[model samples]
Target chain A: SQQGEEDPQALSIQEGENATMNCSYKTSINNLQWYRQNSGRGLVHLILIRSNEREKHSGRLRVTLDTSKKSSSLLITASRAADTASYFCATDKNTGNQFYFGTGTSLTVIP
Target chain B: GAGVSQSPSNKVTEKGKDVELRCDPISGHTALYWYRQSLGQGLEFLIYFQGNSAPDKSGLPSDRFSAERTGGSVSTLTIQRTQQEDSAVYLCASRRPANTGELFFGEGSRLTVL
Candidate 1:
């Protein structure tokens, strides 16, 4: 089970507030990726942080990876109600580009 | 396809029946993957194929689970004698060789075994 685990299984916040989710994995990884899934929809890749890098950002999303701690965090600043979704962290440490996804963090932003 | 595509968006089957889910990856994507998500659970790694060859099938839960890719494009996952536990959303994703970018995903096939 190379599966990563995301903490704060569920989070609720108001619009314009920051939402943060953490993920921890058990093995070395080439890269870690975060994805957002709207209900009943396919996942949308949000960001990917390489093991060698500590942080990366895309739009309002900021991702930080701490390899020494084997963990990562995703921060959505100034979140909107539209940002509500299930966030998952996936690690590409297994063979054949296979990914082990975390249990996910369900975020709900109130309007 | 513009993106990874999966067929039979929803399926309701009786226990002990066989079900086949299909995936059509984005054009020219060489890496294909199959994953499962039980309700309210994390994604479960099932298998991945590189250019029509599956080098890793370790995540498959049992003999009843199998997957294959043909023409290096489309893939199919077959579940035999599905139990209630086999019910889940099967997701497909594809990426280019050596690319660490985002993996394109399909909407997924939701299976419900009664």
Candidate 2:
């Protein structure tokens, strides 16, 4: 079963706009990580937010976690045409080591 | 390898045939994972391996799917008697042990079952 489900199955926005996607999970997680996929090949890790951490940032990426709500969100600042891709959230359950991924959010950035 | 490596960037097979996908993780990484992604779908966790412990196979969709890791370095995912539904990209990733580290992934093997 998928542990997380991302909102806004697909989104379209002009370049330079900020894109935000949300993921909701069922159980407590050791960490929540976001990834990007281009052309549906392989995923590239963007940022990881540990359970104890409420938020984290890396370059143009920002991630926030709310354990009480069992949800996380990924924010891409200043989105570019190249940033158009599918984004997924993976949660590592605190009860186990396995990571479960959510159905991705497909973002289309129009140049 | 500097990053995770997967074999046969693409594979096309007839239904009912068996196929094997291989993954070689970065040196010394003690954790590895395999996932399947269908067209326009998110990754479905298939299996996970950590060190020499028994793998977590709970996510495998069926008995026809099996994976094994050798020497904690390379891993193989074998799908027996493939079905049309098995057509998807198989991705492999590796991460450091017992840490909140990011996973390093390979350019997945695209499987086409006809």
Candidate 3:
């Protein structure tokens, strides 16, 4: 499958700590995006890093991409209970508009 | 709607029945997508629509699953002869035609087949 896969299916962290999740895909991509889903419903876009870029940061979230390795990682600094959610990585391949998503990482922040 | 909107947030039906899910994408967005997620599972790509171009239904699991985007705006996903395995949350998302590639999603429609 061309879908991406996330490592460490689940993670738990204390408030003020940092949480990290990694994703690996199998094909060339135009860009990679991170999304957060609360209560298993809609997913909210977090960040996007083009294949040409190595890293990008948005607010408390930081994303890094290594196209040669076909891997990407997301780091949430100063985690909070409200940040508990499933994080997904999506890849937009160079050939199409469809974005394939990863299995996702479930995150829990202890208050 | 300020964001993508979906109808019938939850639905329960018997096996062999047919069901349709609706999605209203954010106005002016030209790209729309459908995905299904089972409990504790990853999102499964279903279909994609980009403006007036023909939809890419390559990810559809079977002929029993089909989707249509009308006038490049609203979309509908139909499931025929539903099975227990078809019980899942169907999510819809839309994106602007710009290069950002960010997708805005709806709350999703949950379907249960018994």
Candidate 4:
């Protein structure tokens, strides 16, 4: 069963705009990580936020965690056409080493 | 300097036929994982291996699916009597044992069942 669920199944925005995607999970997690996947390719790790941490940033990506709400959000600022891709959130529950991924949000940025 | 690598980037197999997919993780990484991604779907965990310990196979969909990690370096996922529903992109990932929270993924092997 999927432990995480991402909202806004699909989003379309203009280049240079900001894009935000939200993910909600069911259980306590050790960490929540986000990944990006281009068409017909593998996933690329973006950033990871530990359970104890509330937020983290890497380059143009920002991630926030709200354990109380069992949710996380990924923010991409100054989005570019190349940033158009599917984004997924994966959760590593504190109890298990396995990670469960959400259905993902497909973002399309028009140049 | 190479990342995780998977063989036969694309595969086409007839129903009931068996198939094997391979993964070679980055050097020195002791943790490996296998996942399946259906079209327009998120990743589904299949198995996980940490060093030489027993692998976690709970995510495997059926008895027909099995996997093994040899020498804690390379791993193989074998599917027997494949079904049309089995067609999906099989992805392999690896990370240092202490950093299992973050995974490095391969290009993935796309399987098409006929």
Candidate 5:
């Protein structure tokens, strides 16, 4: 069973615009991490926000976690064509380290 | 290896045939995981290995699916009597310990069941 659900299945935007993706999970998590995957490749870890931490930033990526709502969002600022790819949210429940993944959000930055 | 490694980047097999996928995790990572991703679908967790024992094999879809990690380094996922529905990309990931650290993944094995 999928533990998380991500919204905006697909999004297209011009370069320099920002992209936002949201994910919601059902259970309490040790940490929520965001990952990026290019076509035909494996996932690349982007950032991890602990349950106690509300927000985290890395490069142009910003991740916010609201455990109260069991939801999290990923925001990409100054999006570029190279940022075109699929983004996924993985939640590691406090009970274990196994991370459950969401369906994912596909973003396309048009140059 | 600096990162997790998987073998036979692509495999095409006939129905009823058996297949084996291999994963070699980073040097001393004690945690490893297997996941399956179908066409444009989310990753479905298959199993997780802590050292040589698997505490969670609950995500395995059927009896045909099984995985094992040896020497706490290399792992293998085996599927018996493959079915068309089993065709998917098998991904392998490894983490350091009992931490919520990020998982490092392999390129993945694309299995095609015909």
Candidate 6:
């Protein structure tokens, strides 16, 4: 079973709008990471938030984590058409080194 | 040379046949991972290898699936007596075990069983 589940399976918005996606996991994790995938291609690493950290930012991306709730969110500011892709959240459990991924959120940006 | 590379970008084989997918990790990477993704579904972990340690095969779906990494760099996933259910994109990723945070992914091999 997938360790994480993402909400809002699909979203559509115009360029320059901000997009938010949420992820919930089952167990304690050492860290959580986000990735983006274009159609039929490899996934690209976006941002990683450690269990000890509550929030992180990278350029236009912002990530927040709440260990107590076992959930996380990724926010993209000033979204662009190129940001249209499937976004996945991956979690690495504290006990194991392997990481499990969520179902993912598909975002479509209208130019 | 700089990123993970997977071979046989696309494959088509008949049922009951065997297929092999290969992955080459980035130079000097210590951890290698294999995952399977069905259309519009989440990635399913298959196997993982770190350094010379024993591989984690807990995620492999069945005995028909097997993977091997040589020199801790290149890995191959082989499936025997393939079935239509085995059709999916197989992705390979690599990272430094110490980091345990980010992973670099390959373009993946799309397998289709007829």
lDDT of 5 by residue, B5-105 (tens): 99989999999999999999988899999999999998999999887564589999999999887778899999999999999999999998766679999
Q: Is the docking of candidate 1 incorrect, acceptable, medium or high quality?
A: medium
Tens-digit per-residue lDDT, B2-106, candidate 2: 888999899999999999999999898899999999999888889999999999998899999999998888999999999999999999999887666688899
What DockQ does predicted model 1 obtain? 0.77
How do the residues A1-111 of candidate 1 rate in per-residue lDDT, one tens digit apiece? 788999999999999999999999999899999999999999999999988899999999999999999999999999999999999999976442778899999999999
Winner on DockQ between 3 and 6 is 6
The reply for model 2, stretches above 4 Å from the true place, is none
Alpha carbon deviation, residue B2, candidate 5 (Å): 1.2
Model 2, C-alpha of A91: deviation from truth (Å):
0.5
Each model's DockQ? Answer: 0.77, 0.73, 0.75, 0.81, 0.83, 0.85
Instruction: Give candidate 5 misplaced runs (Cα > 4 Å).
Output: none
- Candidate 3 per-residue lDDT, tens place, B1-114, comes to 899999999999999999999999999999999999998878999999988999999999989999999888999999999999999999999999865578899999999999
Whole-model alpha-carbon lDDT for candidate 6: 0.95
Please give the ranking of all candidate structures by DockQ, highest first, separated by commas. 6, 5, 4, 1, 3, 2
Per prediction, the TM-score for chain B is 0.96, 0.97, 0.97, 0.97, 0.96, 0.98
Q: All candidates: CA RMSD in angstroms?
A: 1.2, 1.2, 0.9, 1.0, 1.0, 0.9
Worst 10 residues of 2 chain A by lDDT: A92-101
CA shift at A104, candidate 5, in angstroms?
0.2
Report how closely model 2 matches the true complex, as a DockQ value: 0.73
Q: Considering every candidate listed, which one attains the maximal DockQ?
A: 6
Off by over 4 Å in 6: none
Q: Give the Cα error of residue B20 in candidate 4, in Å.
A: 0.3
Q: Which parts of model 4 are misplaced by more than 4 Å?
A: none
Tens-digit per-residue lDDT, B1-114, candidate 1: 688899999999999999999999999889888999999988998998887464489889999999888888889999999999999999999998778768889999999999
lDDT of 3 by residue, A1-111 (tens): 889999889999899999999999999999999999998579999998999999999999999999999999999999999999999999977865889899999999999
Comparison by lDDT, 2 against 4, better one: 4
Steric clash pairs (candidate 1): none
Share of the reference A-B contacts seen in candidate 4: 0.88
